[model samples]
Target: MDSSSLIASPSLARRSKQLFLGTRLKSEQLDETMLPKRVALPIFASDALSSVAYAPDEVFIMLAVAGATAYAWSWKVALAVAVVLMAVVASYRQTVHAYPSGGGDYEVATVNLGRRAGVTVASALLVDYVLTVAVSISSGSQYAAAALPALSGHEPTVAVALVVVLAAVNLRGVRESGALFAVPTYTFMAALLGMAAVGLFRLLTGTLPQVESAELQVVPAAGFEEPLTTLGLLLLLARAFSSGCAALTGVEAISNGVPAFRKPKSRNAATTLLLLGLIAVSMMVSIIVLANQMGMRYVDPHQLDQLRTADGSALPAGYDQHTVIAQIAGALFADFPPAFYLVVSMTGVILVLAANTAFNGFPVLASILARDGLAPRALGARGDRLAFSNGIVFLAGLAIVLILAFDAETTRLIQLYIVGVFVSFTMSQLGMLRHWTGRLREVHDPRTRHRMLRSRAINAFGLALTSVVLVVILVTKFLAGAWIAILAMAIFYFLMLQVRRHYDQVAEELESDEQDSVMPTRVHAVVLVSRLHKPTLRAIAYARATRPNVLECLHVDTDTEETRELMRQWQESGQEVALRVLHSPYRELVRPVVAYTAELRAANPRGVVAVYIPEYVVGRWWEQLLHNQTALRLKARLLFRPAVMVTSVPFQLSSSHAALQRRERDLDRARPGDVRQGRPPRSFTRR
Candidate 1:
């Protein structure tokens, strides 16, 4: 058939098109769904920006391991972390330019390194994506619980619900969800940066107040009271830097989502990456500096005994310590309580929105992996909303599982978070170095070669810096729960390999062969008669309509009386087809039919056996349960048999007709603009 003729045929296209229209977007509408820079920033940068809320706490918490004596190094650690962030951002700009297809690290490593490198990057990225959702939402839920005491005990539930809601927004469409998230994202940036500006001005004017925790002295962990050895101090510093590197977790997302941006996708993505790095660094440094100036003390909540009063006595009962950001905001805005509340509220909202970046990045990366046969093919498909629905659901489900498992505690989850992201970061930069080296060999122009060389140098530096950070993270955090993330990465890596192997095996087995192209010798048809009802009659009629070589009515004698009555009726009705009954000693329904079909197929090895089973189409829930049970089992069994075709001839009952009419009414009731603008009906699937 010609393409134009196929398009014009209603019978061939209408039903199939209708089945998918509501759940899938048309190929032509893809461009309309592309995100602009304004919307793309929030969609792709929220996670990085939101990291500022908790990264500083992680830094201080690590320093608290050695007590208040080590707190002076917090700002220096933050500075080092900021420097690393700049290098990563610069490295990723080159990545986005080279790979504007939204593959991110996985693509960079695959093309420049090798398949194993690509799979490793993919596994790390997938794990990081799940951790981002878990940590972000969990932290957000923590802030929310603090704000509303009633929610304190239900943080995990709230976190899971936020994940579900975020998934729904993302499944709606990228541009649409981006637009929705833009408000809170922008609000958060403004609130945080504004707080920083106001607090800095207050400090310059000599009016800044100390934090509430400033009065409490932090007791050092055992053995830290004595003078520290060189090894101990170095390990403490490494631990602090590794913890602060949490701010760098989401920086790779912009590169992963380059294709989602409008025209000049690479340039736009690069610009967004720079903006993310600058904003995140600024916020993180500001928070860290502010915390230092206010003398904020952060420690594991379980180790509350480490905090003592000014007299070196223990704190009073129920002395709950707020987060570093929370303490800073409260101390900075002591007089203006509403501003503190605003900052707190926006911080929580922004943290939840931060997970949206993962929602955006994970699917795009998964789609790339799927295309490369490293993941399920379903992850590669776009839904009715033109988003990767399967990947989104998969990420959300994994995140929810993690949240529930960890009781929505950010501190615990954060330990497993940065390892994967940094692994991808270090490997990606190394791959970029290789990429630039290969490109330099092919380029002859002086200016272009110089630029390529400069880019290669930047990536080389990024590789060195991130490599150190990755080592530090593994060393400092390995025993402290980071091993879970490494184990998860290993699991995903092998699982993808298995999935790819299965897909390859299926593809090779299904490959066309000239020798196997010949037609069947003959077609033998069998109509399964469960009862002499309207459905059975319809099935028999449909089977006869096919006009096969030989036809017979088959029945399982599960009950002798019923079989006898059916056979008598067949004889009295004078049917041309003979009734074939197989007596079942065990009185089983599905097994007898399966055995008969297999026997017939074995007798005619070269012939095709087509089985027609009567199925009722009912509307009400209970009615549906009452029918199709036996037919479903028979079809399921016959589907695995070679040369056997099971066709369900559905006899629509009166309720089914009503249900069809109701569906048509719902279709007609769609938004007027949807029809007027030539858009198809939207799928009600919430992804």
Candidate 2:
């Protein structure tokens, strides 16, 4: 049989895969997969935008520890987060233009700082991306539970299911996933922004009403029972600001995904970054301001002990504490039930889709790492759909583990959230600073120098701000959960370094030398025979066709009767090759064959011993277990012998023909990415 006949066709599993992930795309369609600005905005910016659903709540939750009195600082904290958000956005605008190759912060750090620094940034971003999916999906699950009470205790399950769904959508291809996600992202924007506008209008017109929690009192925590001093208040606000900086989580995604954008990739990416910053900051500040205006009080969902009724008593038996956005939506659309549900439902949907940002960014980052030999090469290869499927599945698996580990609790996961992002943020800003400084040195043109100087200033400010925020996050959250993220980053950093080292060592060891061009002195072919069957005869025929200096059939005397019968059949059939038998007192088939091949190699040290073993090509998977047991074992042993070449001579069964036909049909079907990969469709006729 020809080599093509050995190929297995599409099975039931492949059909199921195609059913879920959609049809595979040819490589030439990669350009068609590039995203327009509209789709790219939602795909890359969803995490940042979706943070409005929870970031403001985190601010309120932190301040609520000091009782409702501390709520006065909520707007200021939101303002701080907004300022940081804008700075990050502006800094990354420079990044997309400077490093439009989609390396994002890692590329910047590696180029301007060093490989170690780049790896540091890459590690941080990788951890951050996993946390993004974890936090976003967990937060979304929380919102989902609030909307559907039946789902309250099942958030982890819901979160995992959501992760699986998102991964499947992403496996379809980047453009397809983006197109699917764009609507929900835009709906979230409109819903939240619309609620903000309406809330602001009501406040101006003196028609605004208090939220359901307005009458509830926020009881002080154990340490904050008394009034806080200035220092205490400063520490409290710092913690709140750090938690609120979740708004900045997805900003770097745009920089990392510049290559995915359509024409004018850099400009579109920068514009998307600007839009993300504006929309996110506006939504976040609006939610905080509106929550404060409506006398909204929120505590950690798990810490409901801190919340009390107007009577200062925990009297309610089944009172649900909805999310900050839910409360705001309820108040703003008190009479409009549909609008309220719309806002809340879309909030949940967007939070789930927010993880899509990580889905898009993580795989691209992993692929880049793979290309640089810092990650597994599989991560760098495009799947049937032209997406980094391995990286996508890997990220999903990590995120699901994190979600389960944290019990899909957003508050708990949020504590571990921003540390890695801020690490990447700080490193990226520092790298950009070095980048602009180096550019300024090279640019003699007056206009170019001026532009470079302006960019440098932006990066300088971003560096200063992000460095401060990183310090605050470490101080306020290290014990809370940020240490876990830091440790994870450290682990990833070490792993990537080790992977790169391994690849380098392998390349060095495999480097061609002058001796590689030399040929062996002669070929000594040996065919292993177990019985006088068609497969055994085929193996002998193939081995003889090579016209080796010496040809022989090797049989192990595992069973004396079988060996004698094989010799009788060999003589009766008048085979051309000489029959040789090795005695096996232990009744072992593989060991005797291995000993003979090693003896042959040792005898003719400069010559090669080629061992051809007959293998059955069975169509059914179960049929495989029934055949080729001895040949497999023998080949495994022979492979380690010096100057030995192991070859499988496949004898096709009738069942294998079915597999060959199926394989041919699959080959005839044109796949999506084939044209781009220079593999055009071709017809095949069975021989």
Candidate 3:
């Protein structure tokens, strides 16, 4: 190798390493304190808590269509939805106890039902994770507008901004943000209870007043006469109740995150499940009750004209409808400005933070799927803190796409919600039943038998309730947009099955053969040269360095002029090797190369053909696109030929110098044993 080539090798290696930075993590660094209960709740259950932010708003919005008469059903629907949530929480609590390894619904279904069912559960949960971010962020932005008037008419911008921020925090690692957010998440619950108590006291004293906007009349959309039939009214009530049940969406997160909990993992997970459900239920019920008392009315943003002014004229355009929790905050803190803003601000912040649950849950679940060989191996890659970095980026891309597509409107996005939650709910409860049945035969104690039986009954009831709700969500929302979610689930299921098949096929192919250790009968070295440049010279030298027999220079003769000149030059230079030019009338590279290799392999079936091609190494990442077109294609075609081996003899040009400098700087900034490694990479440490 020349002096210039020697320098280039180190430069190219340095740059190649940069693409892989921040991707590798040590497993040992992923420990328990990384997931304390407070942070874990926000990290895992924020999706559930944030639902209370807008689920109540939807309840009031739908009911207000029928005038004040519809307000009476708010608490009833909230209680009914809570019953389902409580049952689901109880079932998942059993799930965590039964399977503390952290696969959650997907694991449960796979263990009990089989692989297909597990894939179904996985697909469902994947869809749910995306919806969790979309719905939560959009709803949070809705709340943000109420607290700060400047945010009006910019809901999508605010929602997407929040999603972007949440994605960054989650990509950093779950434990870090969990520790940071535990107080704020808990405060959301505390604030809801405190407001509920204050509202109750004011009600008892006959001093509770309605919200300022609540008195504005809500004219029903251009649909039916005011006096409706019992069946029509009940169906509308069912639709409203089903929408409200979005509050139950994130209850299964604890089951998914049991492995993140402290020792006595099952117990801790179960207790967390209980805590999340109770807190979510209380907040949901309180908001609904308060909205009803305040006489709040809302409608689909597109149907705002339905809400008329007191004089029977249309309410003005651009009239902002504050959500239920916002309305309650405005009413309760009418006298306390700071208290009012704090509740509204945190409520908005918590909504965005709620997406954190999806961010953490998605990557973890994806890693499990990848480990099981049912997803792309990239999903298995962990971050510097041993978190699933690829999975986080994947979730962010999906959420961002959905946000942009739907314009981050909660009203439109809400239609796609709840389907994934119910799918997992029904499947998990079924898995739990199978779980208890499997455990019953192994247990000898009578107390154990009785407790198992009780758990089974609760799960069975939960299954029944969730099944009904799933049907209701589908019936009411399928046309409205839930079909898109169902389609997404189906697509994910099939794609995962294909991934598993690919992994299995690869494993089978990679299995050792009896002749794997055998040396080749002959090593035929072919130096593929396109031009007489530094890269070509480097390729020839590298191939010669290997010192193989039957060494020859092969070129695809696309045009007459280049091949003749190359041959003349080879002769004039008195080169030791002969130049063999093959004419290609079609001027194609990959096909002719493939055909040539096949011919060589046919002549010597037992021999190995090692083809060396010179490739350019560039400084800027984008500069890579400008080079290596033919070599990349050649490598790809050669890969399919089992007998042919391809090697890249990279020739780094001076343009690659910048990339080398950047890597050297990065290495210095984050050297091993440096204090900057405040958190070790968990992925590398684990394996």
| Cand. 1 TM to true fold | 0.92
TM-scores, each model vs. reference: 0.92, 0.94, 0.86
lDDT of 1 by residue, 180-261 (tens): 9999999889989999998899889988889999988899987788767899999999998998898898889988888899
Give stretches of model 3 more than 4 Å off.
1-25, 143-158, 213-230, 298-301, 305-318, 512-521, 529-549, 555-576, 582-595, 614-630, 649-687
Residue 180 error for model 2, in Å? 0.9
lDDT of 2 by residue, 193-263 (tens): 99999999999999989998999988998899999999999999999999899889999999889889998
414: Cα error in model 2, Å = 1.4
Error of 2 at 542 (Å): 2.7
**TM accuracy, model 2:** 0.94
Best by TM-score: 2
Q: Which ten residues in a row have the lowest lDDT in candidate 2?
A: 1-10
For model 2, what is the error of residue 409's alpha carbon versus the real structure, in angstroms, after optimal superposition?
2.0
List candidate 1 stretches off by more than 4 Å.
Answer: 1-25, 531-538, 544-547, 619-622, 668-672, 679-687
